[model samples]
Target: MMTSLFDQFASPTMLGIPLIVIAVMLPWTMFPSPTPQWVTNRVITIQMWLANRFTNQLMTPLSLGGHKWALLLTSLMLYLITINMLGLLPYTFTPTTQLSMNMGFAFPLWLATLIIGMRDQPTMSLGHLLPEGTPVPLIPALIVIETISLFIRPLALGVRLTANLTAGHLLIQLLATAVYVLLPLMPTVALLTAAVFFLLTLLEIAVALIQAYVFVLLLSLYLQENI
Candidate 1:
């Protein structure tokens, strides 16, 4: 039987148990924990530097109240980048490929921002629904449209990450299949195809990193409006 190209995305199972849990947790285990010492190794030094840089950049625009999310957001960024990088490895599952998983991450966080806005600044939150200069005739229609867009934010977040990762994986798989097929019939073309596959793999790596950063960046933006 011919196998589907999309089958790589199937959630891995062992003895009827889904392996997504392992995939998610495995990345964290790979990270080395810091320790107290006169001096640290290069790994620890680089990690500390990156952690500090990321947090400072992320929290720069938010108020002091929003700085409270520094740990949570920084942890999330590392978690996502780890899983995404790990997924690029052979025979590994990417939990973020699942829309359900993506939604699980996006919804609560987005809702938290919305809740903060409504709680702390009800007037400002409601004001966003209608612009100050909205024409009289378009007031009702504008409200309806903005309300719909507001509710759509979480869905957009989840779907954007899922779709970008899914598309990249599908393209990589297709090119790989082509390389295998061409190897037997046309050695020269197969070599060129293999070259392209290598380039695509690099692009996918960048995509994984970029998508994770974009996801967290958007969440920060949402939080900024609230705080």
Candidate 2:
């Protein structure tokens, strides 16, 4: 009757419908819609401030053309952060821990940047494959290497997010199991294990926020290169 640690990552269902659909949609309702008022609540104020700051920081490195993505990227960032933080709650599934979901977000955005670069500035886009001043002997090798690196970006993005969240979740479950088992036999050891579990939970919360930010930030960098 014991459950596997990774069983928590599996998508739950209700009436045979995947609960992930609900999990993804639930975060959107957590935010309040903007109101037309002279003074807004503190929640609205703080949310606006965070959005502005994040957008500014994310767009600073890119050209004006990249500014067009400010809305899309900002919205995606908030959605991701909300999902990640919510997943930390009890009985919740973290969809980002799944490779398919992470890649669903990563690949299309990465490809869009590449397409924009190719469409608007084909020379510069292709030039990225081979740097200037390369020796004749090294030209083919360098081009092949760069080409492989370029295609690997999306895979790296998806795997990085999935790996980090999955690892954190697994460690947490292992520690929790240890604490429970130890409590029945060794009180002192159980207390120490519990304390470590608490700290690791806090760290996981931060990791959730950070991984979401890093995902969006990398997307922006890819866009910058294209723009």
Candidate 3:
């Protein structure tokens, strides 16, 4: 029974081909491509509006060098949002919930920011390890601590996304199971549970959107520091 609860998280396969690959690629098909018309349809207009707004907001805090990432970050934000929201549908697998996949998304991007810092401004980047005006004795220990924290960023990014989505999914499943089991035995309790489940579903939807945004937002912050 315990094992059954987590079965949904197992990667689905067909004749040894992983369905995760399909899931990751599916979101791209949902967006409508723009036409050559001078004025576009409402869907394309809204897409343009949202993309412009997000790009403007994200680029606000960034330096001119960092502005180059605006397009990549905006597209990533949309992709994540679509993927996360789609997972909330019945019988769908969320790719972001897997640690390995989330790490794949996080590590390379995190490393890119690190590389930019090291290559462009090695002194300034290393200086981030030690605070200004530190005591002679504390410098070594602080540098070591900062170094550990630096390396841990990607791990933290992956774990945060995976943990939040996993926990929410598990709770929703438990509540669903409770509703199903209690329906005949205790109609009133089951009704209440179903109501709670409905509310939780809404919250989970919000969480899906927020988590995607937070993931991208953190990447931007990392880029800000480096650039």
Which ten-residue region of model 2 has the weakest summed lDDT?
A: 83-92
lDDT, candidate 1, equals 0.92
TM-score, per-candidate, Cα-based: 0.97, 0.98, 0.97
Give per-residue CA lDDT, model 3, range 67-184, as digits (tens). Answer: 9999899988999889888888889999988999999999999999999999999999999999999999999999999999999999999999899999999999999999999999
Q: State in Å the error of residue 171, model 3.
A: 0.8
Candidate 2 local lDDT, 105-135, one digit each (tens): 9999999999999999999999999999999
The predicted structure with the larger lDDT, 1 or 2, is 2
The collision pairs in model 2 are none
What does the lDDT read for residue 136 in candidate 1?
100
Error of 2 at 1 (Å): 1.9
Question: Which window of 10 residues has the lowest lDDT sum in candidate 3?
Answer: 1-10
Q: Where is model 1 more than 4 Å wrong at Cα?
A: none
Look at candidate 1 and give me any clashing residue pairs: none
Clashes of each: 0, 0, 0
Off by over 4 Å in 2: none
TM accuracy, model 2: 0.98
